[model samples]
Target: MVDYIDQHRERFGVEPICRILRRAGIQIAPSSYYAAKTRPPSPRAVADQQRLEMIRRVHVDNYGVYGVRKMHAELNRRGHRIARCTVHRLMRGDGLRGVS
Candidate 1:
């Protein structure tokens, strides 16, 4: 929704786009969008971005055959102490599915 707003905001303006979305039952406030646009990324977002880089490195270092479980284990082996679910989510986001 924010992406849609961004794509059209220059032509229609953020408030107008937000109002249209609200009328369409999406309920997104322009202030929320403005806040999001100005706010710095949260700590978790920074961590996730860092984790994503680490995940890609690990996946390539292991020949890209390591699925979520093995990738989780490998990250732990390298002293990452990250959760299995987080690894899974990151890997899935990057389309980094492992071989069976």
Candidate 2:
């Protein structure tokens, strides 16, 4: 929705787009769009981005053969202190899978 607004905003403006969306049952407000544009990423989001970089580096370095278990152990061995489920979630989200 935000992306849609961004694409058409220059032509239609944020308030008009939001008003149209509200009339169409989407319930989005212009302030909501502005707030979303202005808000900073959360702490967990920052951490996950950092962890994702590390995970990608590890996965590529190990020839992409490390599944979740090995990846979790390897990250722990490197002193990352990340949870296995977090690793699984990130890997899955990024479509980084091991050769099972």
Candidate 3:
């Protein structure tokens, strides 16, 4: 709704839009929206991006046949020290699937 508020604030107004959103259970303070728009990504987000890139490279290098278990093993074998669940989570988020 931040994008919608930004585009239509001149017509509908910011507080009015936020009020409407709140009624729909999508609560947001204008200050929060503006702050989120200006702030840089958090450290966790940066780490997730880095890990996702590495995961994609592993997936591609292994011919995309390995599932979460093998994917975690391969990443560990390469000295990554990442968790199996994290690999599975990233794979699912990216729409990746094993050949099984």
Candidate 4:
């Protein structure tokens, strides 16, 4: 069901996708997609945003001298509950790097 919705989400808008799915014997409704879209983000997403903000601050506060490993350790020490790879991804997205 999720795969069906994902496959058509781009080609067809949510309404049309739900219509097609309903016609094809799927139980999803347009309202479901609408509700999903309008719903607040999950806790993990909110936490990730906060963690990413911390990573950015740490990077900038150190004049971009913090790389993923150090950033990951620092975030862990600060109770962010994130992975080193996640720190790497966020730092890479923000174009931050170690002083080297």
Candidate 5:
């Protein structure tokens, strides 16, 4: 429901959408719309957990010699869509440093 409202919000402005939903007895607040847009991850948080797991596995699989940067590159090479910072966090937490 929120997703539908958000997707069509541009086409039929915020107030109007709110009005329509309210008329249909959905009872969504204006603040709710704003909150949904600004709130942090739900699905993304779960995905990041999975991604970090993969990163940790990759790090250990490589004999714990790969640092965040290298791990990020390898993850990308292996077609995992993830951010470098996430890789950094995972590596840092595991204390896996690169051999420079």
Candidate 6:
């Protein structure tokens, strides 16, 4: 929604777009759009970026043969203390897969 607003803002303006969205029951305000645009990255997002780099390095270092299970174990064994589910989520999100 924010991206949509950004794309059309120069032509239609933010308030008008927000008004239309509100009329259509989307309930977004111009302030909401501005706030979203100005807000800094969240802690979780920062952590995810750092962890993703680590995951990529580990995956590549091992020839990309590690599946979720092995990847999770390797991260933990290296003192990352990350959950298996997190490893799985990040791997899947980045389209990183392992040999079956």
Candidate 3, run of 10 with poorest lDDT: 29-38
Higher-ranked by lDDT: 1 or 2: 2
The better-scoring model by TM-score among 1 and 4 is: 1
Runs in model 1 deviating more than 4 A are: none
TM-score of each: 0.93, 0.85, 0.82, 0.56, 0.50, 0.85
Residue lDDT tens for model 6, 1-100: 9999989999999999999999999999889999999999999999999999999999999999999999999998899988888999999999999998
- How high is the lDDT of residue 96 in model 1? 95
Q: lDDT per residue, candidate 5, 1-100, as tens digits?
A: 6788879988998889889899999988888988988988799678867887887788779987887788888999999977888777766766668877
In terms of lDDT, model 6 sits at 0.95
How well is each residue in 1-100 modelled by candidate 2, as lDDT tens digits? 9999999999999999999999999999988999998999999999999999999999999999999999999999999999999999999999999997
Ranking by TM-score: 1, 2, 6, 3, 4, 5
**Least accurate 10 contiguous residues by lDDT in model 6:** 76-85
List RMSD in Å for every model shown: 1.1, 1.6, 2.6, 5.5, 11.7, 1.6
Q: What tens digits encode model 4's per-residue C-alpha lDDT throughout 1-100?
A: 5556777788877778778778889888877766776789899789778877888887787787877888888878878788888888777877778877
- Deviation in angstroms for 89 in model 5? 2.4
- Provide the global lDDT of candidate 2 against the true structure: 0.97
Displacement of residue 69 (Cα, Å) in model 5 is 1.2
Top candidate when judged by lDDT against the true structure: 2
| Clashing pairs counted in every model | 0, 0, 0, 0, 0, 0
Error of 3 at 6 (Å): 6.9
The parts of candidate 5 lying over 4 Å away from their true place are: 1-41
TM-score winner, 2 or 4: 2
Q: Which residue segments of model 6 deviate by more than 4 Å?
A: none
